[model samples]
Target: MKRLLLERALYPLLGLAVIVVAWQLYTQLYAVSRIVLPSPSDIALASVRHFALLLAQTWPTLGATVLGFVIALVLGIPLAVCVANSRVLNLTLYPILVATQSVPKVAIAPIVLVWFGFGMESKLAIAFLVAFFPIVVDTATGLRSTPPGLLELARSLRASPWQVFSKVQMPAALPFVFSGAKVAITLAVIGAVIGEFVGSVDGLGNLLLAANSQLESPLAWAALIWLSALGIVLFAAVALVERLVVPWGHSGR
Candidate 1:
């Protein structure tokens, strides 16, 4: 395990080092204007100088992401359960859900901003909309995909509905729920960026856009890197939670 992890870390680090070296060489050799293409060192210096300001602005976006993800989880799981339990609701709502996803989220961002305003609420709404579908689909499928034998056994034992759901269905659904959450984390960041792009005057997205307008390409790249890191960190967090909660889920696979 240690060797594998070290190997994984080494390759990425080495790749980054090579890219940075090449970027530095290219900028110097070609005499590229710093405005046009800042070297990796330029980004590093910018990151250091602006770290405090960046973190402060980052907090609101992170908060919105968390709030949206939590809301998605709370509402999604229950709605998924309802759909799983009722064939009529499932048949009706499933197509609606699919149709909703077919609409481009970016095109709807302005409407959501108008409806919810430019505050954190709008950003959260965007994140929620982006994240909601995956959670609902994954959880509903997990619940419905319960093994026939186990469900039959539960029925044979005259298990109460609540008991069967809690004891059998929920456990089976956890891995899928986590899978959806993993996808949702990345989407949550994207949604926040989109919200910022459309309505908000803050967040990494806004910062990036401002940097672009000012032709501060290095700062824009820095913000992009930060955003990527945030998404990766959120995704890793969900994976860690999954490892803790459902270690056996992928034992064979």
Candidate 2:
């Protein structure tokens, strides 16, 4: 366990530390303007100085991201099941999903803002839009990828469709569902930031933009770091859940 922790966590932290030290040295030796690039120390100081404000602004983004991700899972899994099970639905809905996905989220943000306003609703909507795709695609793939022999055996045993789905298919799909969830959660953060960038009065994204516009580079960088941290935390959460629910899948790795 200790070795695993060192390999997975400590090494990454050490690498990051090295990068930060190198960055600080470069800035000091060359006198890089703080406006163009704030040193790590400056960003750290800014984070500490405005920690309360940053924490306050983080809630909205976090709420939108988490809620949107949950919504994606709630809707996407069932949708994937329907599409995977029904050839007609797959033929009908899959193309529409693809078409909508092709349209840039940035382009749709303004319309979402108009519909949902500059509130958390807009952010949530945008997050849902971004996170929904991967969940559906990956889950459907998993369902289809279920070993034919297992499915045939279940059928031969006279297992009901629901029984086969709930027992055989869902278990096989767990890894894929979690994979999509990991991707969706990170994209949820991006989507929330996009909504905030387009129009919002709160969130870390707004804070970052305000700091940047006011030439408070350190504060902006701090917010950027916080955003990265938030994404990492969320991704880690999904991964932890995956490990718990699908232990056999990750045992070798």
Best candidate, TM-score = 2
lDDT of 1 by residue, 36-150 (tens): 8888888888888889867877888888887888899999999999999998999999999999999999999999999999888888999999989899999999999998899
- Model 2 C-alpha lDDT per residue in residues 1-253, reported as the tens digit of each score: 8899779988889999999999999999999999999999999999999999999999999999999999999999999999999999999999999998999999999999999998999999999999999999999999989999999999999999999999999999989999999999999999999999999999999999999999999999999999999999999999999998999888576
Query: Local error of candidate 1 at 147, Å?
Result: 1.6
Model 2 residue runs over 4 Å out of place are: 251-253
Model 1 spans > 4 angstroms off: none
Give the whole-model CA lDDT for all candidates, comma-separated.
0.90, 0.96
lDDT of 1 at 234: 90
lDDT of model 2 at residue 112?
98
Per-candidate TM-score against the hidden true structure: 0.95, 0.97
